[model samples]
Target: MDDTGLLVIVDAANVVGSVPDGWWRDRRGAAERLRDRLAAEGVPGHPGPVEIVLVTEGAARGVESVPGVLLDPAQGSGDDRMVDLVAEAGVFFFFFFFSDRELRRRVTSLGADVTGPRAVRPAGGAWAPRRDG
Candidate 1:
């Protein structure tokens, strides 16, 4: 087990893109919105206390960190960064990753638990809820 508590690293683009929304027009905005929600509600299924890291890249780059969520803005490939994070944490550590197929194998090989966007976003919702005016 990790000397530190659980780590939850979210793939900002993956989660944002997983749900169709006006995010295409404002990628950073969507990422920020997601960050806020994660900071507030957190991703479900965590067995105990945990820390959250939101990895931002490509269109969602430059999103800043909030109180509970640490923003990891990838310099290039977000997948590479996510891999690096898990690698840094020894195998005993428990991590929950929010991503899809491409990096699952690699992440699993490193011994980190992986999950999909559905764990965070609501099921059957085509679009992320827009902020109220």
Candidate 2:
């Protein structure tokens, strides 16, 4: 979308919720941790550069955007906001990180490539670049 690389929109709530590492105790901290992870690791299967938009809502709001990641705080429903982003982007190629089936379907219907939260962070709660030969 920005001519840099794929536009990766991350569902913070879904991604964070994907793991049960006591994140529910600190929602904002969890989102920030995810943001920092993105800033450091980036979208793992995607080799090229990318523009990452981390969408946050509820207690996760007010999270600041880092260098490689931009924060999008949703006023109401985070799912709705993500849908609006895909619709507004038109036919641009996108890589979306989401675990929500309905949200995945909605974005995919708009021609987005949807993947699970593990795409950003594995189920083990760690993110290491895939080394494929």
Whole-model Cα lDDT of every candidate shown, in order: 0.79, 0.86
lDDT of 1 by residue, 3-105 (tens): 6577888888888888767688888888988899888887676646778889999878888999989999999899999999888866455555565676898
**Model 1 regions lying over 4 Å from their true place:** 1-4, 123-133
What's the CA RMSD for each of the models? 2.5, 6.1
lDDT of 2: 0.86
User: Candidate 2 at 28: error in angstroms?
Assistant: 0.3
Judging by lDDT against the true structure, name the best candidate. 2
On the 0 to 100 scale, the lDDT of residue 4 in model 2 is: 61
lDDT of 2 at 132: 42
**Could you tell me how far off, in angstroms, the CA of residue 107 lies in candidate 2 after the best superposition?**
0.8
Which pairs in model 1 have colliding backbones?
none
> Candidate 1 overall Cα lDDT vs. reference?
0.79
Q: Could you tell me the TM-score of candidate 1?
A: 0.85
